[model samples]
Target chain A: MNPKPDKKIPALYGGIIMGLISAIPFVNIINCLCCTGILLGGFLAVMFYKNNFTPGTPPFTAGDCLAVGALAGIVGAVVDTVLSLMFLAIFGDVTQQYILDLIRNMDIQVPEEFYELFEEAMRQEMAGFAIIMNFFFALILDVLFGLLGGLIGYSVFKPKGQQPLQPSPPPFMPQAS
Target chain B: MLLRFFSPTFLIDTVVMKASFPYIVLVCLAFIWCIAPVLPPMLAWHVSPANPLSSQLYTWFSHICHQVDSRSLHLFGMKLSVCARCSGIYVGFFLGVVLSPFLSRRVSLSAIKWWALALLPMLIDIALDVLGIHSSTIVTRVATGVVFGVNAAFILTPLIEESLEKFIPMNWGQRKQGVFYESQTR
Candidate 1:
């Protein structure tokens, strides 16, 4: 019997998809809808893994889906952090400027102290420690959301009333004269 | 029909309650998750505005939410940690989970189809707003978010319960067989 296909390649593909959606500016907005991007990644990973199954192999289980999703999430977190840092280097905190523009456009009253605090927080956010913290937090969320996505994938893709393959009987031999 | 729907006999099933322990636990966790974002503003109001805890909460939520103050709901003169749409989604999810047991368990639509239907309105609203066609108000944002959230809960809860049922028994059987064989060998 053939062994089940390795999960790493599919997981990597899923992670790349997650990273691109999460790290890209403006595109990352989709994630605000309950981490939809991360979920999609995990779901796609399960789909890819399911495609690898052949007849006679043990059917993929929910536990397998969970593990693949979590691995994808870890990879995605790394990719997202790297891409975000690269964007930050190029764009110089576009998010902060966007927020300032929004506040200005809204004409909301803000105390000067709030501005000071916001700037202080922004400064700290750019620091190495903050970036690492952000990565860890993202990792936690990605794994959780990914697991959910895996469950959804399993429900959608599970074969109806699948049973184990029975070994075929050996060919009957004719009696010799 | 409405009265029957609200009746205690219809609403509460002891067997379902016993069977749905995981679902109940999930609902509680979701409640906590939804409430976390709201508490920062309240804490800032009741306690010092400069409270580190509130700031921490805001910072934590910022990862997941754009949190544009203009687009967020304000309470106690402070913006929520998440946007109005996110707030609506979270609240609606909690409501959906609470109501799931009483609602019909049978699902006619597939998961992807259900998700697409749920997301359609939000996508249209966002597209229009982005194109400078129509600006989305807080009401529109919240309404769309709620639709998506409610649909998501209805789809996910049953699937999760089913998966748990499938996974738990296999493990239980293995453990039981292993114990039996070990005792027989002894």
Candidate 2:
């Protein structure tokens, strides 16, 4: 039986979850672990999809993982863009200053122009560029991480072995006395 | 969780896609790991400020690492792309790859737990620092990072090998050669 369960909804849910998590300020710290947060989103999507699907259909494949991950990543990128804009608008200078302060505490020396460009973006003079950059980053990162997560999730949750299709009840046969 | 590493059906799938070889990819990643740390210092030494590559690497890594100068190793009087901890992690990954051959030829899923265990000290160190119980310095950070990184290497190398090695295509008519391989192993 073709188990054509809709993969889109699950992927959408995953993308939104990842985007929201990545957008938050302090909470984003969880991502310090190799973007595992975004990867989880992808894994969860496949889990959700698998849960909803009936058994006795073609088992899920890596190609399926790629599709779901790509969808989620694309959606997550858009959601992330909107959230970044919102955060920038709301926090404005405080957020800018915080990042600048962190950068200043570091010991590295950089060309003066690089600092100027970063400042320009933080000040919103380069708002459009910043948004575009964030969009691309999220899009790329989510897709790659999502696929990897999907692989991990599949391994974790995959059924041990397809229960041998319940042996068809012994074919009803009339036994001669 | 580690049991997930060696699922038989997963191996079957790996045999089919036959994309890039895992060992080759690992080697490439190892190269990148080595070079990523070295790039910043090298750029500072030779590349002009006007060069986009010089600026690009700094900007990209800034988002990922704190890149604190005092906490990073210097090459040619320049800071690394990441802080000392990150540098150790990458270098550790290289060591992990080298060390993996000595540990096991088959994918040993149980080793994953050890990798997580190795990471605990770093987490504890960071937590204590954040709570103001104690502050960590470059030495503490890099040392903890090395422990975690070394174990992480063992976990990752086998994973990459198991998940990806079978993807290398066989000579023509070699599809399903796995059935024969499976029987032989049995």
Candidate 3:
């Protein structure tokens, strides 16, 4: 695009939205919709980009979409990690209790060792912050889904049939014997 | 006309099969493989309650899903690999893949926005129930999830097509014609 829209602000806004939606309890179910909520953040970023950048200048390319999406993804990862950890800190034990209850209902015979392992793992995850797991999940899911959302946004936002410079074929000439 | 969409070639090759052939192949296979866990989990549960496959499915999906029994659909007298809403989303994604070809490959945000719209009722149902606004049902969850998932397919199929174009400039014919020539990734 000929004009510049400060890209970072919109992307950060979008990423934050994605992260909060993905991290929140109950609301996080929206990710069940094939990460629709997360991708929407990326889509929103592109929408902001389009609105700010003059339309039809260079046209928003897929590359632009990916960049915006990626920025949103990175921001989303940070947000998701912090929020998930915080939420886990507050409700982690309760959530685990619910899981235990469900296991009893299911009547599955889990060895005592597994529960011990799970508890130990959880404690470690909480204590160590498990930034690696959170960051990895966020990075993969955010970038991929965000890129998709950007593409959808592109389809919706991009002006249609506006290829202003189609090369014309040579004029037809009659052949002489 | 629609039959062509279901033909073996269509299933095998996909929309614009010849364009960005490699990316399409890779993405489709990867997605299929990723979502393939649902069935195995059920089978494992049937075979042995604590079967490895079933346990593994639970362990992995637990990160992504709530996996509460009440919220999940039961098959073979056992809980599914994931919650009901989640199951609906996955199944709906399959349907979306089926329907994508019939839909316009239009690059319209409106086309993509429907997925969010689809989720409104589900979100409302949950909020209402949680807040004691009203009670929500499992059906509500699954139905809303399906709507979101199906719409997602509409967005995704096109994205895959677009991504391929962006990544690989050459069409199938061009690649085939120049097969023996010095090739470059770009």
Candidate 4:
């Protein structure tokens, strides 16, 4: 059997899905539910990997899922950061305006100082330090959550009717005669 | 008296403790995770010098949560590191972990369905707010979050435990491969 298919393709597929969901404005709200979008990406990666298995291949294991999930997470984090930068370049911080409008519509009474701090932070969001920090944190969270998703995927997608290989019976021997 | 050390009871006790090491570690990590969010607000309120640390935590959590001020619970005049919904989830998760010992250890694939069912309330709450059918209050968010979290803890903990049992012993390089695989098969 072909050595369990290369993980890169599955990881890339999962990463792209994660990045798009996370970077898109409005669509990203799904992540607010415990980073569900990222988790879904990891789960999909494992699912894709499981599809690669064929008869006589090494049986799927939890470790394989974990490694693929983590790789996808790393790729996802990079994709997310790049796409976020692209969006900022094109839309010019629309997310900041969106938040401000949301707060106003909700009639929340935030302090004047808070507004100043928020605006200041938004302005600095494009800076090198902030971008690096964001990537760093995103990487950590994505990897952790992705690992969890992989484990869940394993539980759900484990192969059926696959039993452990029993040891061969002791060789037949004739009694001394 | 020395023979007592080799007794079945003593041997079983030793094996059990070794097996439980990973579970204990997981519980400790969960406790830390649950408590981390509370520290930011408490530190901001009580220790002026710790403001930087508190700010760091808020920043760290910001990625995972929206952290809308009005939607969050306030402690010591400062908003929590995460929103009330997230807070409820964490608290509920901790409670679930603590209580999981009393729950059934046999978690089947069907537990996933129950976990999904638990998320229904939260989804409905979000959908209502988004559709302008009804504005979800803080109580609704927290309540739904708690339900989801508890179910998540129940479903995921056993899976994690089972996986760890399969792998952790291998890391120690002690158990024979045939014996290990045989145990897993059983």
Every candidate's DockQ is 0.15, 0.08, 0.15, 0.18
Model 2, span A53-163: residue lDDT tens = 666667765556556766877777787678867776787645557777777889978778977887776676236776687677777777876866665555555565632
Task: Return the top candidate by lDDT.
Answer: 1
Per residue, candidate 4 scores C-alpha lDDT tens digits across B9-84 of 7544443333354455566778998899889989987888367999899988887888989899888888888898
Lowest summed lDDT across 10 adjacent residues in model 2 chain A is found at A163-172
Give the best candidate by DockQ: 4
Chain B of candidate 3 vs. true chain B, TM: 0.68
lDDT of each residue in B1-186, candidate 2, tens digit only = 444335665434442223234554665778685687677668768876446776677766654566768778788777887788887777777777655654534434443346457779899989999999999888898888787777766655544554454564343224456666788999
Candidate order (TM-score): 4, 1, 2, 3
- Model 1 C-alpha lDDT per residue in residues B57-170, reported as the tens digit of each score: 997887778798899999988999999999988888887766565552544665567778878999999999999999999999999988877877776665554455554443
**Chain B TM-scores across candidates:** 0.78, 0.69, 0.68, 0.74
State model 4's lDDT: 0.76
Error of 1 at B144 (Å): 1.7
Docking class of 2: incorrect
RMSD of 2: 11.9
What is the CA-based DockQ of model 1? 0.15
TM-score of chain A taken by itself, candidate 2: 0.74
**Model 4 residue A155 lDDT?**
59
Off by over 4 Å in 1: A1-3, A86-123, A160-177, B1-17, B131-134, B165-186
Better of 1 and 2 by lDDT: 1
lDDT of each candidate versus the true structure: 0.77, 0.66, 0.68, 0.76
RMSD of each: 11.1, 11.9, 8.2, 9.6
